[model samples]
Target: MDVSKPPFGDDDAHLRETTVSSQTVYQGHFLQLKRDEIALPDGGRAAREYVIHPGAVMIVAVLPDGRLVMERQYRYPVRQTMIEFPAGKLDAGEGGLACAQRELHEETGYRARRWARAGVMHPVIGYATEVIEIWFADELTLEQRHLDEGEFLDVFAASQDQLEAWMQAGQLTDAKTIVGMMWLQRWRAGHCQFDWQTVD
Candidate 1:
């Protein structure tokens, strides 16, 4: 053990896992499964398997009436419908903000005039490199929605109080949406700030 170097230190001396080799075990339409041989910090080697994602974006779309646009969609893997913010995976070469705009309009039929980046998160850091960019959208206008073929979801609006209550009652369990709600609470309470921008 290196006493001078801590695991969370600035340098990589204490926590270095070098990838000796990598192989793609499976490749799907939007995800790739990879297995890698890594040299551990100690004198040992290990095999790690994970998924590769194209990244994604989540929108906390707020209406002028102090309500949020939310969605209820069935998640196949979980075999249940979940309440979540409008979100979608980024297309190849698409910017984060562009993806957010596209998903919001496609899912909720609303376009936002004002946009702000809230933050980024890794929902599956342990097994996947899926990064989701969080965005706040406001000053919205009604627009025609174009959901992807074979997609079905119910879009609705909810107040902050209602959302908080749902969360407390375990009705809201989506990780990204929970994070977005926390950001919203912080922003509303003056505990956090956002860099607002105008969408063209």
Candidate 2:
């Protein structure tokens, strides 16, 4: 399948809303959205479900030597240590750019003089509409890093070749890390064709 092309066409029928459902389930971090079953073009009632989320932000930090600055931390939910870009869910009224700046500083002890939007992605569109906005942070300087309670992570810089080796060998599994690094790499190479496809 071509990644550049979206499978479904953008048509009125594609977004056709037939039945409405009032049922809702809230779970703090996410909400379950349910719509009443409706008849499809084939004369069948299709069940539709979607998870609502507040979205998220992440940052890809780059040093002068084309090295990637990333984090290694133990994720509580996954119960494993993983590598990822500095990231977090947006606080109430917090903008994506601001969240990226704050998270990068807090997690990596690095501050960027310039920042750019990397890309926004849908991790799991089949269930959750959890879109994540990524940013690129450059012209960095090390600052006082303030870690939250129970938050433990290591920050380091590595060549993309090294990261790719680690990834191919099953070392790095975090989605944000992979996405940020890929986008940043493309951006630096001047090969990105769209603004939403890469930062700056």
Output the number of the TM-score-best candidate: 1
Q: For each candidate, what TM-score against the reference? A: 0.94, 0.80
- Residue-level lDDT of model 2, residues 19-125, one tens digit each, is 53434644554445654455565455676676777889988778988787878888888899987778877777888987887888888889888777867998888
Give stretches of model 1 more than 4 Å off.
Answer: 1-9
- State the C-alpha lDDT per candidate: 0.95, 0.78
Quality of model 2 by C-alpha lDDT:
0.78
Give the per-residue lDDT of model 1 (tens digit) for 1-200: 89746777577766879899999999999999999999999969999999999999999999999999999999999999999999999999999999999999999999999999988999999899999999999999988899999999999999999999999999999999999998999999998889999986
* lDDT against true structure, model 1: 0.95
